[model samples]
Target: MQPNKIKIKNYQLNSNLMLAPMAGITDTVLRSIVRSMDKDCLLVTEMLSSEALVNNPNAKILESNENESPLAFQLSGHKPHIMAKAAKIIENKADFIDINMGCPVKKVVCGGDGSALMKTPQLASDIVKAIKDHVNKPVTVKFRLGWTLDTKNFVEFGKLMEESGADAITLHARTRSQMYADKADWAEISKLVNEVKIPIYANGDITNIKNAIECLNLSKANGLAIGRGALGNPFLFKQLEHYFNTGEILPEQSLKEKIETLKEHLNCEIAHRGEENGIKFFRKFYPYYIKGIRGGGAYRGKLVTEDNYNNIINLLDEIIENEQKILHIHSAN
Candidate 1:
């Protein structure tokens, strides 16, 4: 009972469940882990600066793994020329080029790009057309409902993207003002679906399988793009894959299993970036992975403050030892 595969233009996306192109989170290591768990899933790179792609020869951030195939490189910029040039540069490396018109970050918005493009329909369309004209790969756009509640222009904007030659569109179901606080409005997503002919991927608030099912049922979208939900749970993609294949919830991860997975993630980060940089980079993920464990906050505080890789490993070993003791006590009782 495998889920039906989706084809976007020339690319045959094996999985309908896609990893949304998160800015700082979806690096090569993370994408590699997710890909290992579900080889069919479409893993996206972080949102790369289009200008940097063209100007910076050291822009190794856009690098992709040979194993992480069917990857889409998401690019963000305001000007059509900058984005077009960026698309041309990555044309060979990336399987698809995704335009970021959905990011609501102040820095991105101030640059007159991201979700700001949603407000300017003509400019958004022009950027899409420019990228499409330049890249041989399929061109996609990720966007929000609109700038504000009063101005929900997704239906019109989606139409503009398709008319301008975008192969697919993903709606993040929240306005720029909402900014991940309010619950996503899937009804608005449904509205956009009725208005567009190309495949639509519903994004935002899909934290679990139930939510994913509800999103697809309510929006009737062709696919789902997972974001924040994947932070500490690389198994999430596997869970969704299992549920979509068999109509049942998979078993939850045990505490020991969770720790081992986190350790693997940390090691991968260390290997991808050097230990010094990896230790600092992985500090942000400590909270997400250690949440709900006893003394989790204390462990996270120590991990963040510790600069040396050996020191961090020693701390993790101590935590694991303490957890084993706790398990022994519970088993005896």
Candidate 2:
């Protein structure tokens, strides 16, 4: 069967695949890279609290450009007025505004935001209505299945958001009590799809093409949102697209390809944030790129400890060269 188009009212994405907005990953540069790979994937920004946006309109996190168009900005907060105000400020720059009610972090939930809002369904609805009224773009909501095991009221929660003026809803099919837990109950997603008229995107533990297929079959969701799975593997999107278009799963990227992408990622970071800060920023992603390679621990250690960008680049080259030869020797033996 052919894949369906991802539609959020008037705001339609080119594919039913999206990159879930992550705290430190989906910045302008990474989003730009993902965008260049897929001309129309739905890209989302890191969660910005209403308080953060209202307090500092010039904050670097809120910056964007045309390269990241069709991008959704996810806002997290409890108050209606504050979120409405923040929505107005970013309305012009975004393709859609997503209200984050899925984050299970204690710090965010303690502030009556994120997944905590799911506990106060009316309050969550109010914020959604307020932002919807304030912004011209379509307003979407991303939330979990429920607060806890016994309180799996996501069926009601999704309906409430749809009734409250949300154009679409993204459900991370896990209760707050089940944060990051591998046992994501995709079966619950079927409930929302059946009960709500709005579009539903499923997120959680979708690590590869196999999981994507199983989740889609179980949830029957309109789209899939991948988070940690995309880390150090941006090529996953291209692979996913190829599968969607042709039903063929691409092979895992080779070591050389992974290292090359890392180099490109480093260069992009350097160009975007400048040399010194860029090298520091790229440090966080080194482990993911070196994953599964022989002697990766030593290389990962070297990557994190090195301070100079030139040295870091040289080290990556050396690691790839030696690892390739080592694997060849192992194969011969």
Candidate 3:
């Protein structure tokens, strides 16, 4: 219930919340929007390959806005030296360098990266120590419970990461085998918190203030890392910050406000990707923006397939109209 500032080595975060690094989702535009809502919350970049950075320092994924500081660049790889090199290359651009060991995607794990690292603790430890040797920035590691239910070595892993010089650890309370299917095991995070000297952030299933409170109470983690829950409602960072500081829950944004925010997101997407590709990229976000609205499922279907930008705007307008009518009817009832 108390607001806590997260101190990662010498870096101090004004807020204990962090935007989890999500591949393909946590790009420059999304980070910028989240920052507009909550300036102090730590923002992280989408996971990038160490190999890609070593091969090309000017990777497009590295592009970021000037305002997105206190940002952490997440790197995914198993090799020690290459990962350290990548970390050094981006040292000036990042407040922290995050190592990815929890991603469960087949393409990533198959190459001895992501959740696969949990199975090789020594190598994972080496990667952390290597990065520490290269960059003076705080080094953090994000990982899941373990490879499977039978292999829930998060407590051991957390200690190892701390010993290997990880300044902080973020634990998504699910095993690699779970693949987000079952409820995250916050109890496991509690175990890790007991074992690690570094700050531990509890992640997974923390979509709202109530969930945040519960996870913190159960895990006693120093902070939280929000991922999928932030998709449609980038306002979450502000909402969480408000609750943590004042203990007053900010009401969720009205339908009209959500639509306006969606428009802003769309405009940014279009500007970044250009008309055609931007509109296409924006399609994937319709469901999150229109979620819970009356008849949103149908509207989402139409919006995703609609290529014309003007048509999409008209469809959003219609959704807002329908939602207002539905709300009015419910009030009368």
Candidate 4:
């Protein structure tokens, strides 16, 4: 069943299916796209560096709008004061401020941020407390199971954050060492759920409504935070909402529907970033949108290399024309 309204202190979210803050993927443009599909799901901005927000103070990462309401700004940094400063900067703009402690990239961890913070509970605790002190917005933390298998300190780490005044927790159920190698350990989330009073969200590898249900059942979490799953499948949020409320699996989107949406996605990016840079950034999303089309492989290769927005629009026109031929013939059955 769908969860009722989830309240994070003063902020209330209608859907428990939260968007995970990805570094480059969940930019303002993508968030804007997700918002058009889902009015209730909580959205998260891409991970921002605390140092950048403090040094430049005009970083584009801080860009947002009320259209993506209940959005959270995720900050990554090691120092308590710098993180605190970054939190304060986005306090008025975001519904809540989320600290990222689960990023597994070597560059991020080596900087004593992301998952490396799991190894230093004291510092992680201080960073949370520091940010809480600087902002009136509810504070949240997204971290992994632990630094490594040998250092499985998630229960202890979660407790530390809870004591440090984190309003919510999102646990990606793998250690930093696990990275994306294996499946998320939902059982571990159960351990933290039992130990903390704050709203704990289960993240990592949750792709569908079934996965969300199983993860919630196993972890007993307040909600599920989806990241990679929502990349080209923003409809997953809507489908999940539908299934949770009715237990009916909605029909998969037709190829024509997907192609049209991809075209819309391209235009949205172009509008946000202009033709040149928008087309460049959008090249990565071709595979996600065109994955199942009959000639998707060759088209993906062609689309990614193309530079002009007009060419992209033409190619999309060609794809839609071909796809609709098969779609209409099949529907007539």
Ranking by lDDT: 3, 2, 4, 1
Q: Root-mean-square deviation of each candidate, in angstroms? A: 1.5, 1.5, 1.3, 1.5
Q: Model 2: which residue pairs collide?
A: none
Task: State every prediction's TM-score relative to the real structure.
Answer: 0.96, 0.96, 0.97, 0.96
Rate residue 92 of model 3 by lDDT. 90
TM-score of candidate 4 to 2 decimals: 0.96
Per-candidate Cα lDDT values, in order, are: 0.86, 0.88, 0.91, 0.87
Candidate 1 lDDT over 1-333, as tens digits, reads 344567888788778888999887899888998887788778889999988888984575876788888788999998999999999988888888999998999999999889999878899889988998887989999999999999988998899999999998889999999888889988679887888778888999898888898888888888889988887787888999888877778887776777777788889888888888887888888887777888998998998899987787788788888999999999999
Q: Candidate 4 lDDT (Cα, whole model)?
A: 0.87
Predicted model with the maximum TM-score: 3
Give the lDDT of residue 204 in candidate 3.
Answer: 95
- In terms of TM-score, how similar is model 3 to the real structure? 0.97
* Model 1, CA-based lDDT: 0.86
Give a tens-digit lDDT track for model 2, residues 1-333. 446978898776779888898988888888887877777788999999899899998788887779888899999999999999999999889999999998999999999999999899999999988988888899999999899989988999999999999998888989998888768888789988999888899988888988988999999999898888888888888888889988888999888888898898889888888988888888899998888888889889999978888888898889878978988899999
Task: Candidate 4: list runs displaced more than 4 Å.
Answer: 328-333
List clash counts for every candidate, in order.
0, 0, 0, 0
Residue-level lDDT tens digits of model 3 in 161-237: 99999999999999999998989888768887777778888999999989999999998899999998899998988
Best by lDDT: 3
